[model samples]
Target: MSAPEDRPLLRVVKGAPDDYQLAALTAVIAGLASVSPAEDKAARRSEWANPARRVRRPLQHGPGAWRASGFPG
Candidate 1:
């Protein structure tokens, strides 16, 4: 195994002196790593285009409504 210093990302992390800088760099790296390829990404949508996919329930008397919504009885 090579020394951590020999690895580019590890070298950068090890060279970060401040705790805040290390934290910020880690967050940035994590965010970048989470990015999906363009073709695999879902199209931007403001709302569910299909009404069938939306949750629908008639407004009713109090506690029973909570039960239907999957809350503890």
Candidate 2:
């Protein structure tokens, strides 16, 4: 017989053993709370803001030597 390979994935097992997941979530929440509110707000804002300082390499084609800028590859 073929192995069971068609089972669907479950985001959360209902009424099942979920203590680990709950523990992990609690840990994450605790960690987040450990940070200062101002610092946390700044970090969250930065996460959405465009990154600063990027590498620019001159392209060998196009009208002028175009350059690409952004986080390092």
Candidate 3:
């Protein structure tokens, strides 16, 4: 059998949606979009709060370690 080709779309209506419809739509929207800016910032901060998970760890420059690692001292 052939696959379906039409994409689903949302239509504007004059009246507001019912409680159930609103909840379902909210869930769907939440699933599609990312968290709020504040929440995202908090998440990033939490990640960086842990030293092991940090993007830049303390560099160990023993003698010429920096030059050996291809980084200018």
Candidate 4:
């Protein structure tokens, strides 16, 4: 791999850095901010559209099975 490609996925530079480093950090921050809201909105909309999807009560007591549970027919 080339030097650039061989670099770690994440890098931390201590102390002061050049303008390029600041620009790169700013770009990364901006990119993250741009995508985060869309992702959150999509997640919220999906939750609202599909919901948790819980089973209704009496799932195990379908139809006339409730009559056998000791309650009045």
Question: Which number leads on TM-score?
Answer: 1
Per-residue lDDT value at 12 in model 2: 52
Residue 50, model 4: Cα distance from true site in angstroms: 16
Determine the backbone clash count of candidate 3: 0
**How far off is residue 25 in model 3, in Å?**
0.5
What is candidate 2's TM-score against the reference? 0.28
Which segments of candidate 1 are over 4 A away from where they belong? 2-9, 13-16, 40-73
Lowest lDDT 10-mer window, candidate 3? 36-45
Better of 3 and 4 by lDDT: 3
Instruction: Tell me how far candidate 3 lies from the true structure as C-alpha RMSD in angstroms.
Output: 14.4
Q: What range of 10 consecutive residues in model 1 has the weakest lDDT sum?
A: 8-17
By lDDT, the best candidate is: 1
Quote the lDDT for 37 in model 3: 56
Model 4 CA deviation exceeding 4 Å by range: 1-14, 37-73
Error of 1 at 8 (Å): 10
Give lDDT tens digits, candidate 4, residues 9-49: 65566778778987798899778877744443443455545
Q: Flag the better candidate by TM-score, 2 or 3.
A: 2
Residue 43, model 4, lDDT: 35
Clashes of each: 0, 0, 0, 0
Give residue 38's lDDT in candidate 3 (0 to 100).
52
List runs of model 3 lying over 4 Å from the truth: 1-13, 35-73
| Whole-model lDDT per candidate | 0.69, 0.56, 0.64, 0.64
TM, every model: 0.35, 0.28, 0.27, 0.31
